[model samples]
Target: MNSIDKELLIKMYMNMVKIRRFEEKANELFLNGEIPGFVHLYIGEEAIATGVMFNLNTDDYITSTHRGHGHTISKGAELKPMMAEIMGKKTGYCHGKGGSMHIADFKVGMLGANGVVGGGFAIATGAALAAKLRGSKQVAVCFFGDGASNRGTFHESLNMASAWRLPVIFVCENNQYASTTPYRTTTSVENIADRAIGYSIPGVVANGNDVFDVYEVAKAAVERAREGGGPTLIEAKTYRIKGHFVGDPEMYRTKEEVNEHFENDDPIKNFKSQVLRRGELTDEEMDDIDKRVADEIKEAVEYGRKSPYPEPEEIYDDLYV
Candidate 1:
């Protein structure tokens, strides 16, 4: 009833599924000694990536966080290459030198995923500034967690984007925790979006667990920025279902908190219900999607498993110019 096209809606769902399956496979690979690095799973934040990326294009750019497989897949990078990269393959986007956290595929406008907590904000802001100066209409999106909101660089990026009228959107996935630390204990602001007032930009908060909610909000922000309206601050209320990293036990939180969010507001489940009840998709279609994603991930795992590690000379290749 929302006038949304069924195919495009399903496309968004597929992207989220791609990310979910990829991250799950990565987790397995890491534990079994295949993907040899610190792997952070983006289990609970798929909707945020799917929603924002649904409105992006090749000219547009995005900055990512440690938990970035979702962002990468949502931007259209093939699953095989990503898995291969984590496996240290020469065919990887980074030639396998920039494993997990440092992965990037700029050809598709994935600036890169930073290992540093707040590193991406400044880089994305600069990319936006470049776009503004060149008179390019492309928008730059910086995806950071709630904890990064308190970083000095985030504030600086916001002020600069506003002052220069850069086409940018700051998407804060306030997933309630940052590496086992509760977000509420860190930030004083009632809403992370409220910080936009300091820079005179528009701000909005949305239920991030709902893909459609984030999609609609992100579309508006992207459109506004494209029209030379400067930046927008969008805070999406979501959560990370898994541990902060593979080794993290997540002792700071309780089983109840995790169960409540994952079981009640799971993005994939909510999307399935809406698509079904809205008559946008058949049960068979949904099942097909599940089957396809499972197969795609299976192939990726095999590719990652067979992929070779970076050659000794390859290590120095990606370091310099």
Candidate 2:
């Protein structure tokens, strides 16, 4: 709060708020069968995406996880196409060919959300290597969960990145539970960031609920990547508010656990409080921004609902050169 400027602080708050509302609406639509395919909502983890995305340029690429709606929005992707994609409309980013997990906006530098665990680690590493070989200062941010940290691709990608000094930031969104199983059961290390030492890269951990904290850490990592320094691993400790996915039965954990994070450690609420406490924004102004973002999401859904579905013949449009 004290570290960020008023404009950026307000913007960070706005982005996190936008993602939260959008995902909430997504859950409602998905339950109603308006959206096709399952979506992994990034409800309580908005701060990590918003803060990390702020450090990137539109030209700097990022690869996302299945829970990628926040990444797309933070990367400046339009809401209509994203919703349209989820709804399986032709107007969507993937023209209805790819649903929630595969929707991408390379125009905005989102490489696409990966469905396979630990897949994007290698993809973003390759992108970074490409950029480095081409002598471009562009950096790549690879977003994955703590569960991926145990995957072989994660270690391989980091090893390659470090060996060649690739410009990439491996941002691990450690949201406590990895689909009902907590990290304590699966991961031995108390801190996921500690794994970076094996790769000989810098590592840091930040409170994922605090957008300001994430932004500061991500800024340093991005600067390091841009300056041709080797990769950095950032483990953002957060909480995922929703179930593993839509329609998940509460078999793994208790309601009390999820409710605690939603009510207490909610990232969006925390961001607004930090900004308002600093007197950077009045409640009235924040309300206005909230209204604006809500209206946008509303229109986005409307546009997707009214837009035409994909034509039968157009299925082969992007299939070949």
Candidate of highest lDDT: 2
Model 2 collision count = 0
Candidate 2 worst ten-residue window by lDDT: 1-10
TM-scores of the models, in the order given: 0.97, 0.98
Candidate 1, 1-321: lDDT as tens digits? 373698888798888888888888788878888777799888888899999988999879999998888888988888888988888787777888788998888889999999999999999999998888898899999999998998999989999999988899999999888777888887898699998899999999988989989999999999999999999999999988989898787889888988988898889988989888878888888788889989999988787777777678765674667
User: CA lDDT, every prediction?
Assistant: 0.88, 0.91
What tens-digit string does per-residue lDDT give for candidate 2 at 1-321?
455777887688789888988999999999998987888999899999999998899999999989899999999999999999989999999999988999799999999998887889999999999899999899999999999899999999999999999999999999987777888898989899999999999989999988888999999999999999979999999988888898888588889988987898988788667667767788998889899999999999999999899999997898888
lDDT of 2: 0.91
Clashing pairs in 1: none
Off by over 4 Å in 2: 1-3
Name the TM-score of candidate 1: 0.97
